[model samples]
Target: MKTSTRLEQAIKKLYVAFHNNTLHPECCKQCAVGNILNNTDSWKHLSDYHGALELNYIGKVNESFGRKFNGYSPSELLKIEATFLKACGYQLPLHYKNSKPKHPTNKDVLFNGLTKVVTFLCELDGVSNVMDYTKLFEFINEKPRFQLDDVITF
Candidate 1:
């Protein structure tokens, strides 16, 4: 398949996972695109439009964060982390305790922080609807390497 088609299929898979309430960490992975065909629950059916929207939104958000701040301050990082969590259809936690600092490099620390944020986002609920893919793409394209394909399927 073409890359565009592959991306579309990936997006569709995400939507299906979302609608079935299977997009959580237990059912899917942090990489939403990879989760599409990762053989999680099972490739039961094509994702509906609603599922696609949710998937696309999450993808856009992830791409946005990756582009905007390759490195970020701790506090700014926390907000970005929160945005990622929300994009994954998760609600922000009532209280967020800071993790201990161990990594020496900014990249290492950012990776560790993102891992925790992704984990927290995966635990959220009540995400069972489609969003506007156009808006998602627009927001994501504000940063580089974050463009949605013109067409999608599967």
Candidate 2:
């Protein structure tokens, strides 16, 4: 089984989180990416010029793959975060509480987000659909130093 890259697993996790609607803090009433979409006050707390929020989904993705801001360069991490958000249909540089992108239709939101995830996955790494959470867990849990290269293509 070829191991998935850090980028691949992160994209997958973000997709799953978005799918499950558990990607954000409970108090925010929005997923992590949702914060960026709304450009609410929460977005600023998640990431500034200093560092990515260790408690947010983006940070969790970074931590899951043993990545460390790729050396504390928060801007780079934010770029990755912004890319993911953009893939989900949100524009960048969330500057205000009312900053918003063209809101996706209810049905299209998931589609857009997933599409972005797939594109990012493909471009950042060579991973594809890579679905199946149970298998991912098995792979990650079975090995002490499991490489996240085993992926399922849709």
Candidate 3:
């Protein structure tokens, strides 16, 4: 599939996850994205547009929770993130910096999936401004729950 096509599919998958509550909306907040990016170099190339979209989605989640940001441990957040990635038919890149690694088909799948999702989010919604990472993390910490049966389709 083309890069753009992959991105579209990824975004759709994320949307489905959000709708189904499989991926916590707060996970995409500005703070959360920043945290993930800071912790992992994988997202360094993410454009401002994509960041904004994520922030917006995170803000929406915060609104729903009546909070600004929810906090969670790095390991806990990783688990949630991994679940979303898996739902989107992708895996977590082994290393943050080497998002687009050469080896391993699984890594390629994840890199492609994340790239598509980020691009779609940047273009489709203005997320950067709406996101608050701190609030997002707090929300996650408050309620760390996932419904395994809740399937997210693209």
Candidate 2 runs further than 4 Å off: 1-5, 24-76, 97-107, 126-154
What is the clash tally of candidate 1?
A: 2
Give the Cα lDDT of each candidate: 0.34, 0.45, 0.36
What C-alpha lDDT, on a 0 to 100 scale, does residue 58 get in candidate 1? 37
Tens-digit lDDT string for candidate 2 (74-99): 33344545554555555444434423
RMSD of each: 17.7, 11.2, 16.9
The TM-score leader among the candidates is 2
* Model 1 lowest lDDT segment of ten: 42-51
Model 3: how large is the Cα RMSD against the reference?
16.9
* Candidate 1 per-residue lDDT over residues 2-113, each given as its tens digit: 3233334444554564455444331224223224445432211112121222223434454456632222222233343344334434433312242223321234333343
Among all windows of ten consecutive residues in candidate 3, which has the lowest summed lDDT? 44-53
Q: Write the per-residue lDDT of candidate 3 for residues 1-154, one digit (tens) a residue.
A: 1223433443455445434434321234322233333323233222223222232444445445654112322333343344434434433442344243233234344444345445434443333312123333333556834332222222
Return whichever of 1 and 3 wins on lDDT.
3
- List runs of model 3 lying over 4 Å from the truth: 1-62, 65-106, 124-154
- What would the TM-scores of all predictions be? 0.27, 0.43, 0.23
Q: Pick the candidate with the highest lDDT.
A: 2
